[model samples]
Target: MHAATTVSLIPVLSDNYVFVLHGGGSGAAVVDPAVAEPVIAWLEERGLELEAILHTHHHNDHIGGTPGLLQRWPQAAVIASAADRERIPLQTQGVQGGDRLTLLGRHLRVVEVPGHTRHHIAYVLEPQAEEAAELFCGDTLFAGGCGRLFEGTPEQMLSSLQSLSALGTSTRVWCAHEYTEGNLRWAAEREPGNSAIAERLAAVQQQRREGQPTIPSSIGVELATNLFVRAQDAAALRQLRGHKDLWRG
Candidate 1:
């Protein structure tokens, strides 16, 4: 079996996380880079070469760093949703759901998750040997919550979340933002008696107190504790989304 791909996080902007995927070699790929200076510094310091830039959506915060990174590594491929070419024009490779790609020697399958944006997409790195699977789900799904309905309906978000839920329990979810603490706090308020939410909130609180990222959450964990993922239907998800939009804590 091939060595498992290594994913490194570089926190940028206020709460966004840029993911760097690399294996045993110096070639690496970045996902949803909010900025480039830090990402460039990270790669240069490690002597890693940028081989590709994977965009989950065309949101500025998600794709703003592409131009700079392309300038630095002109040969790196820009992969994004084909339906969103107008917004994410730098994409050298336009892809859609079910498209397969081999980046940094790991196989990735695209999964359409259009809720945060009409053309939002995710990349699932198939598990190899003993390593767990990886999902780079931009702003669609969070640790204990989901992205707001910006350009899609509740039904679409529900469908998107359901599709992601089927990725298996062991898949490691790498969402773009650092909104876990707030998401869990709101979830605990909604499900006051849920021990899973309560316990996970406590653990996450400790992790935040230590300034640690609560990211790379497993699918099993989200299925158990995330209110959005556990919602029964579009109506339930809509209600939850509305409540979360107004929630201050």
Candidate 2:
């Protein structure tokens, strides 16, 4: 059996998270690094060396730190969407959906999830031994919300979300932002009678009060409490997205 891959969350910028993955070795890989100093520091503290950098889209926050990280480890492989080469010029191994790659002994499958950007993608680490599969979903799917329709339509976004929702229920979702509390609060407001949303909101709020992260939410949790995931169709998802975009609290 393959050694279990371990993931560490490095909170950066205002609400973004940079995920570092490794398999008990000095070699490590990071996903969607919004900034470099903290990530570099975190890895150095653990005596880890960056081996690869993965990008989900061309957003400044997602790729801004790549140059800095590359400066530290010039040989590190920079992986991103081939269609976005012009936008993400630093990528060394441009990939597309259905492609697979191995890193730190873990096999990762690329999933195209365009909505936040025209070529957004996600990485899913196949399950090994006792470890549940992990999903580094960038901004495509969140704990209680999904990315806005920045470069794609509602239908595309809905399709993208559904594809992610199809992952194994035990899969751990490591979204790139810390928007869980706010998303759940809005969900509760949208559905005032939903006990699932209400309960989840309360729990998330408490977690924030204690200065804790509500990330790495499971597919099961999102399937049960995320309004976007529960949306019946594209029309329903569009309506919910509009409401969420205008939500103030």
Model 2 weakest lDDT span, ten residues long: 1-10
Off by over 4 Å in 1: none
> Which lDDT tens digits does candidate 2 get at residues 150-222?
9998888888888888997899999999999989989888889999999999999999999999989999999
lDDT tens per residue, model 1, 17-121:
999999888999999998999999999999999999999999999999999999999999999999999999999999999999999888999999998899999
**What TM-score against the true fold does each predicted structure earn?**
0.99, 0.98
lDDT of each: 0.96, 0.92
Query: Which number leads on lDDT?
Result: 1
> Where is the poorest 10-residue window by lDDT in model 1?
1-10
Per-candidate clash tally: 0, 0
Candidate 2 TM-score versus the reference: 0.98
Q: Write out the backbone clash pairs for model 2.
A: none
RMSD of 2: 0.9
